[model samples]
Target: MKFALTLVSGLLFNSIAQAGVGTELVADGFERPVWVGAPDSVKGKIWVMEQAGTVWIVDLKTGKKAEEPFLKIVPKVERKGNEQGLLGLAFAPDFAESGRYYVNYNEKGGETQIVRFVTEDGKTTDPDSGETIFQYDQPYANHNGGWLDFGPDGLLYVATGDGGSANDPKNLSQDLGSPLGKLLRLDVTGKEGYKPAEGNAFAGVDGALPEIHAFGLRNPWRCSFDAETGDFWIGDVGQNAWEEINVVKGNKTGGLNFGWRLREGDIKTPGRKGKEIGGKIPENYHAPIYVYAHGSGGTQGLSVTGGYVYRGSAVPDLKGRYIFADYQNPRIWSLREKGGKSTDFQDHTKALQPDGGRISLISSFGEDASGELYITDLTGPVYKIVEK
Candidate 1:
């Protein structure tokens, strides 16, 4: 493990020296844009994903959305619920040479599909060329944990939610047999359509699926790996009392069980009844790095929206801190990770919300090939992090 950290079950109350960072509008006029990113080989452009089944290419220099979408599969996509639709996209490591990319979307009958497509010119891809490499049925619509990306190891990592209901009705998070409620590692090549990524935790284990890398997640919203350190970071949305941020350091990559159903944030999940509602908490559960209480209203949490660690040249103060926020509350914050503890905690909410603009509904955060960070709010605006 490259890091060591304990879980924090309550709100951070430290008022330390602030990181001099803010956001500027990068592009606007998108429809429920859920993610934005670009391949390392590509520069000056980023692809934005709309939850309603569209991928748009935006020019960073012009700050304009592309006239035509890079990818569209709305007719095949089933976007009936709030959580279902085209949720993620990742360009292959060798995308510059191979022009291959992948997407994660929900099918008509509530199935999660991982499809691969080839782009001749790297600008657009034909839906006809897309092939579903992996698929699985989703029991419910709400907790469709749809986030996928290529890690530093060039393997595809996917986040999935537990069988969705209050307090994990089926307790799928702890079930080794199911792929639900787990982070999956997959390898994709020309010959092997889709298989377990090498060194996956359950590759040779009996009964468990080989694709599983880490298990026991409630609804991981948006996650990213530190471009510099390779450490994994995620914002796992909580059920009742809290919202959390979890980190698994770089060198150690598999066999992690983040307690859910049985544990939310750092405490036992408080369900409709009490903490006794879910099953037993494991002896050695991997706890969240940070947790915060619900935003006043008990109805929904300040749902966590995970973001990347800033490594761009523009912001020296925010150079190595992990920045993240919530959906319902939408207040952004940054904290330094040292010795497995969060220090130098700074609230970047006021600074990020520029000139009376609101980032009220954060869907996800993005990073381009240049290591700059961007935020995608469900409402339409995509903002870039800048020195303020």
Candidate 2:
């Protein structure tokens, strides 16, 4: 499916009300569902990734999950940490012919691995067919950024978190040599070793890894491209006080710093104290488009879950509005940006309530082939956003 980029004008907060938005239960009995996606070849089938190392296909028409998993590798995955497991999945844009898909997961030894697999049949994958693309040793377990996506340019984009620990102790986010804490774009179409995509900012720069597309990210738990505009959106998890949502124009390539340990969500964070040669904040950094505090007060949120901009016709009011949520608070919000700044925002949690009850631990948000939105809860069950 192809989408055209169009700028929306005259959009006001009062005109786009949240009352028309709601959630409908689609599937249940999932184990720590973290990511969800759909292949372009499949019309109504949605592929869901469970953190415990399994993938399931759900038929939207019947609202039933396939009894047999699409893929399973529990024995090879390590799920000891709250964030570890089979983290991400993305289907090749030419999946109809190639039958290829990619996954990012933590290996049994706590190392991160990106692998490509092929489906023997149309519906399922052979466990032995996985071909390792690359693997990296993770210094800590907590912030393994897990998101795989195919950009409109036909390249694979990978999100990696800073090597875990409080406040990025090793200052890895700013280190150009390390792959951790960076967004990478690779030409995965080749069968052998991967190559950095053309126009990468650090392609031939000295002391910089060629694969680094963008750096200085803490834990970009979830990120997606706007199907309509091709612009990139990222939800970078914060340290203690704030959560941020960042946007990179679709035309820009790389060398964009997101200000991780130096500045967390527009506030200059204190430098590492009581240590030898504490880290210095870089002068060049990109601030998030929008940010919210982490607290019990009104409009405060915890752990931003990056989501998609509604381009589906089902929700007319949501068109062009970016829908996202808080993993800790379970509240959903819609943000409208104009001229690279947020213009309107609304809390839609109450509108999404099916029984005056909130959906808890929203792990991820997904977009279907038709552009409709779906969300997965870590507790269990998947819900589709619909007209109330």
Candidate 3:
């Protein structure tokens, strides 16, 4: 049942610190916190999402979580499976003014729902205010890709996993008809229900889902946009042999295919080795910018957890470099992409280890209003990236 996690032992477990980079404890005591983010309109506070269906506000200065959750929908959420539950939250780009925000969760009926609501104050929302912007039934429980955010273009972007099960029995990643295993773009800006963003890759195309901007993603656990360049980044978890980091630079994000069940980190997946995509395979599939094989110690890791390009003033040395890590092997590292190549790779694991606690099982990474980065540990603590 815990197949994905049980295979985490393959990453190299080196604890070497690279110097100049570390992490400071921001808050602790969260229950399986899957996400943490700051609304640009809000200052010095962050919202944390617990997998059990509660989003709480935490004061950055005191590390104190509010006595009451900012939002709670536990009874309607289904967490029976290891990967199911309330998994993501994002404040609208204009949240400071409109009081509107969104949440992505698994409803009790086995559908992954993306809902919109309004909060008069920064702290809370009415349980009955939820308006479903989108909902889809998941074929299986495991790989429900649950990350969503507003891209630099101000449109909502969502990630969904292939209808789960080993080797993607349905082959949804390569299918144009199914929404699962794809990056979707939607316009939630109007007064009415949502619409596929005007330029989504498959909009108006025959047979393909209108919201699909890119296809062939297995399970993108975390993704972010670079603050300065607006480049899109993804940490797509691989099936058996590898974990990869993918990117679409300069905001040119439409119609790309991130080879998934067909290929895992540039290699044919063991289960899909002989299968072809009905045409030439390599020409259209976008390869990962960087990929680490599951191996003994060092940079090898299982379950890649993608992070942001450091843009915070607090870590000047890290500026412009992308920070990422592994959930199972638990190491931190950074690299720079220049001229379409990943350079300057450095391991920050030893340096990022919290003085009083450990950064085990990193569920997701966060970016605050100031562009500083934070990491959420499924075990509890949230740590902020900082200069050592």
Candidate 4:
């Protein structure tokens, strides 16, 4: 049985020229931007992380962007080629007081590292407060997990891609010892820096990172917590055949292995070599709640760029919808469940990158203090998803 549902009464469709749900370009003039963070401590300001390692601060209320890049670590850091560099950021849940935050970036050696830093007087100049929270090696560049958020449980959850270079090599997705291809739960609120969150199912398990909450995933390109339910939605980009979205709710057992090399979507296969002899695997290794073919429509394909569950009041029609986009194309789609089966409800690509820019490559989607969705175009500008 497929667990999917469609919440909207009528689908809001669009074409290449025009969009339906009114997405006004709130900001522009970004250079190869990939991620955005709306830190509440900054008075509802949105911070954007550029591919070149600079963070741009945009004031949401004033429609003004800081003249100087908020923070620039790129000059010293190496971004050799694609799928690397600054990727994710989040303000500490208690940012108003501490003015502390975290960052996700890949080094010149192609390893993913999460670091904690404190801005000096709300400015990003000479950040002398840098602390290494955690670091993981990436075998390839493409699948470095791109988003981080503090869950309702107050644990910091970080997403790491399957050790990259196409096709899971180390099979880290199912290997508990590896942090690759998993959602990690870490206790960063302590004086000890980042430790495994207590009560994590694998915390005491030998040969494990103790921070892992779930495994068996491809590139979890983007993941976010549901506003109302606090459930997690991971858009794991698939290889060649299938794309999947996995749901992880709070306080559940820390081990739901979303099938990857063993099977793509719900299709059972013995191996990635394309053997189809497997009967039925354990239900424990679950399939996607929603799946799509690479040749679905529009671009006829979409690589996962996971986004937030809409909680913005501006778009009452999209209150609970999951908004996501593809990396190869400018097309954006919405997924909602109806009768336990998820369906693509709308296509809002026409309004995306409205300036007709190339390389729409959406690396991440962001949410403000008010819970509105903001998208970062890899080689473009940060856009706010507003109602039409």
Candidate 5:
């Protein structure tokens, strides 16, 4: 039986006073999974990334994990304890036809690289077949960035973390010279591998790769595009305080500096302030639509995880809600953005995954062709978000 349209629960369903949320464990029992992807093009396979450098394709129809993997890059990944191994994956726009897909992982020396390839039943190729679309050197481990996604503009977008190690020692996020801690957009349609789209900010610049769309972000963990508006929502994880989520228009300006190591949330960078070198304050920096104080245990297990805007017909109350999660604590939160007033949805979080960690490291949310949403627990499980 096909399970894409069916709703299944993991834990025993506990009906609470909450009106619209449904809870369950759709798929469980696997290894240390990190990221998840289920393109509308692929019918039954729910792709998951294992921290040990392997990809598992789970068939929603059978609820059975594929014995073979869609891709594996163990030989190239560094199995460091906190942050290493295969991290993110994305199927090409023509994946069903071309069978091509992409992944972002930490290589042997711990550098992050975006590699693309073609897949048949369940396997990926090497450097010869899959070229390195982009590569950046990593100073230390931990924040290597998150998933790869194709924006509404049809360009492949990548999110890279600030050069790791406590604060941004390199201040790479603010430096346009470096690609670290930035969001890159590239035209992967034609040309050999990847190229900056024509209208990209630095498209004509001599030295810069046109793909550099926006720079100065500190580990934009998970980002998404609204189906109706095409606006991009970015969840940039904070250092000590303030986890932020910013939404920008489809045709907005690039070169946005998200003030890392310099400014966390709206607060000014300590010591250095006012017109100093590398100390330019973001007077009009795109402020996050929503800001959560890091002090709450909410950010404990709480690295920010991006979720989808509820556009599915299943839940009317959640129709325009922006659902997100904190990785550390695994708590799910929602924000309702309407008429310029962004009201925090506190009722829903208490409703779904109340205890948190029902799914750990809630990496990324998946939407099927029909626009229904699915949540991937970092530890090898997938759940469909249903409304009671």
Candidate 6:
């Protein structure tokens, strides 16, 4: 159920020769690796999320995967489509003491589930200990937006896609009552039901769902907070014509609307015939800081896989650049932003190429505990970003 988009021509072969950064194969042989993360407390261990409901622990020092899974919930996951399965994972801030973690996935009935689990000894999780934290029905399968990460404020932030189907037939992105197409911040520290964080934009709104932190996003494949500055970045997948990357300054409050059905990447998208809601567009719809068309030409990418801003010391040149990739086109780019504006952009796909060919089907990008970046390919391998 990967989002349906028009296929475009591949990147020019010459471009791969121009990349300045290279990638080293770190691990391979897994089923649809969607994400990779490491707990702050773990120095040399990394966890990789396979789309088919298993998390494998990898030892960075030896590059060997553990004999057993760190966590597995295949029985509860629905993997009938490409977009479903175990999509996200986050380690609690105090993971060393509590041995607790969270995950986002599609359950047996295609519903989105956010559940918490605790590892008794800090190595493996007891499958039976899963505590259901949140559940929501999805009308369509493709745009589930399953990405979750803890913000610098120490609250859980969840991203959900606009309730599926082409052209947003239901206009869910504009509906405050619906959790789809929005970013939600929750205080999950409590053992019972979660509560909206106190300073959330909609916390006290009359008819709005209090959990909402921001609205008007399509399928935000990945979003993350800068560990250094606390700024937020989201790579939002676009419809027929564009792909976008958006940011929320560290100081802004919630309730920022990124124009979706009303507009797509700064261009007005007329409502679909017979499904039009005819609502007035908001005056302050946030525009994407960077956008690329869907085509074979320069600066175009099929689907944007949002990544982290490099804060690691290994690659001095990429220190402050935001790294991202295109899932379909299999190209990587580093965006340099200063004072909330994009200052430079570079394509690094060629540098990441292995002897066989270019990295294909990059499903997601990940950050290790040290802030170094990694890219996961749907076929199997995960590569670490390195200086050429």
Model 6 residue 81 lDDT score: 64
Tens-digit lDDT track for model 6 on 35-55?
A: 998988887778989988999
Q: Superposing all C-alpha atoms, what RMSD in Å does each candidate have to the true structure?
A: 3.9, 4.9, 3.8, 4.4, 7.2, 3.7
Worst 10 residues of 3 by lDDT: 1-10
The lDDT per prediction is 0.81, 0.82, 0.84, 0.71, 0.68, 0.81
Q: What lDDT score is found at residue 153 in candidate 6? A: 85
Give candidate 6's error at residue 335 in angstroms. Answer: 1.1
Tell me the lDDT of model 6 at 222. Answer: 89
Model 3 agreement with the true structure over 329-385: per-residue lDDT tens digits: 887888888766677677787788888667878888898889999999999989999
Error of 2 at 122 (Å): 2.1
Candidate 6 Cα outliers beyond 4 Å, as residue runs: 1-20, 251-253, 270-281
Report the C-alpha lDDT of model 5 over 243-274, residue by residue, as the tens digit.
77777766363766566756765565444334
Q: What TM value does model 1 have?
A: 0.93
TM-score of each: 0.93, 0.93, 0.93, 0.87, 0.86, 0.93
Cα error, residue 198 of model 1, in Å, equals 2.3
Best by lDDT: 3
* Model 4 lDDT tens row, 1-388: 0001212234333334333465556577777777776765454688877877888788886767888876788854447756677877878888777777888888778778788887766766564457888988887767777578788887888888887775676667778898898878888997647888888767778898788877777777778888788878888887766667666654363777777666666665335466443335554675566665566466335577778789878778677888877676456777675444565456667654454554266777888878888887765667777766
Model 2 clash pairs are none
Cα displacement (angstroms), candidate 4, residue 152, comes to: 0.8
Write out the backbone clash pairs for model 1.
none
**Candidate 2 C-alpha lDDT tens digits along 109-217:** 7899999999867688887789998778889888999888899999999999987877888889888899998999999989776889888878899999888888989
What is the model-wide C-alpha lDDT for candidate 2?
0.82
